[model samples]
Target: MCHMTACSLLSYIAIAWLKMVPMQTIRSRVQFMKISTLSLIFCASVVSGNVSLKYLPVSFNQAIGATTPFFTAVFAYLMTQKREAWLTYVTLIPVVTGVVIASGGEPSFHLFGFIMCVAATAARALKSVLQGILLSSEGEKLNSMNLLLYMAPIAVVFLLPATLIMEENVVGITMALAREDTRIVWLLLFNSSLAYFVNLTNFLVTKHTSALTLQVLGNAKGAVAVVISILIFRNPVSVTGMLGYSLTVIGVILYSEAKKRSR
Candidate 1:
């Protein structure tokens, strides 16, 4: 929580120093409301996602997350009534089916965890779609850094109370741990720096592409993370799971090609 807060503060400061837009010019109640809404969704997704991790294996959590594209497509259709190529819809089928197959093979699964994961995934998709819609309007368009500068502080506000309630001893624990291991401090600083970049890039991506495209990329990212984990951690993997993940990757590739050709 502290890391996130620091990163958000740094991002806001960096943007101000760059003079992209005066902080005063960015003030609007409507804009605040929009950013606050996104902050709430972002907070819910992160909290639920982390909570789900306690009850589900990391692999299962990721497998469930890989269904983000499906929800993205559904929400995009419902919200905008936009239609995609038949091939785009066809490619989404395998993307979902593969995740289902992989999740079915998980040795550990809990109903609560499954529900939370689903909620998190849906919220994430909604965030992306809503961000795209919000930024698509000529009146609402703001540069990515400016958007993050505003949104990050709102997120910090939303997260602060929750951190206090849920992690009451976090400060004490961190202080104690940091005394023994200065590496903890360095790691946190590194993490905070990366978090800023993550937020910046996320806004940039949503600005450049539709939410469905971002979700498709997210699905591919999950597959890549799984492969990295298997390689770096020597994690055990079943043949069925491997095959399912392979199918998802292929689907992502096909979906990318279809989207490019459509464009």
Candidate 2:
């Protein structure tokens, strides 16, 4: 959770400095405040979901991620007073099915594990739904850069205190910053710059795309992250996991196609 907060802070700094997005508004102060407040809740949920990963298996975490679209549908429906048809509500079937099929398989399933993963999913799904609301409600007022400006840094506030309270070797992180390790620094750099850029891109996508499309794509991001984890972290993958991933992608496509019909 702390780390996610820090990441949000880092993202904020990156967003503020890079300014060329074109979301002009008369209510700059109001919008800023609104954005900041929303982001705080947003960060809490995002951080909570992410931190849950520490206690749960990564694959399990990924499975939790697959629920995001369902949450988004509910949130969007409630906020917009846009009741989905029976088919729209039913779209969840493929989304969840694909996720289950794709989750690579976790060996050590337990009550605690189930609880942790469910909690994580709930957190992330809520966050995703709120973000979609934010996008739908205020996207034109916030291009990618402005969105970053408002959110990335605001997110870090959640992390700083957590770092001080929860973890040891805060000094090490500082010392790590001081060192000339291009490797480690690049990781931070990548997270701050590239990650934030991707976040902004996602905002743009969510704005132009349906909430369901955004979520479907977002799930794909999780799968891609898993692939990256395998490559960079050398995490082992199972055939079931691969199969599950395939199903998830297929399910996402079905959901997207179904969603497209409504639009």
TM-scores, all candidates, are 0.85, 0.71
Clashes of 1: 0
lDDT, candidate 1, 128-231, per-residue tens: 78877877766777666666666777778878888878887888999999999999999988887887877666656767787557656666677777777667
- Give one digit per residue, the lDDT tens place, for model 2 in 1-263: 33444445655455445443443442566666666666676665655555666665565466656666676677667767767667766777766775565443644334565565666566555665555455556433445455555565666665567667877888687567658565766675556565555665676786777556675677677778767756765556567766765666566666667777877
Q: Against the hidden true structure, what lDDT does model 2 obtain?
A: 0.61
lDDT of each: 0.75, 0.61
The RMSD of every model to the true structure, in order and in angstroms, is: 3.0, 4.5
Candidate 2 off by > 4 Å: 1-19, 23-33, 97-105, 108-117, 135-140, 173-182, 203-219, 227-246
TM-score of model number 2: 0.71
Look at candidate 2 and tell me the lDDT of residue 18.
49
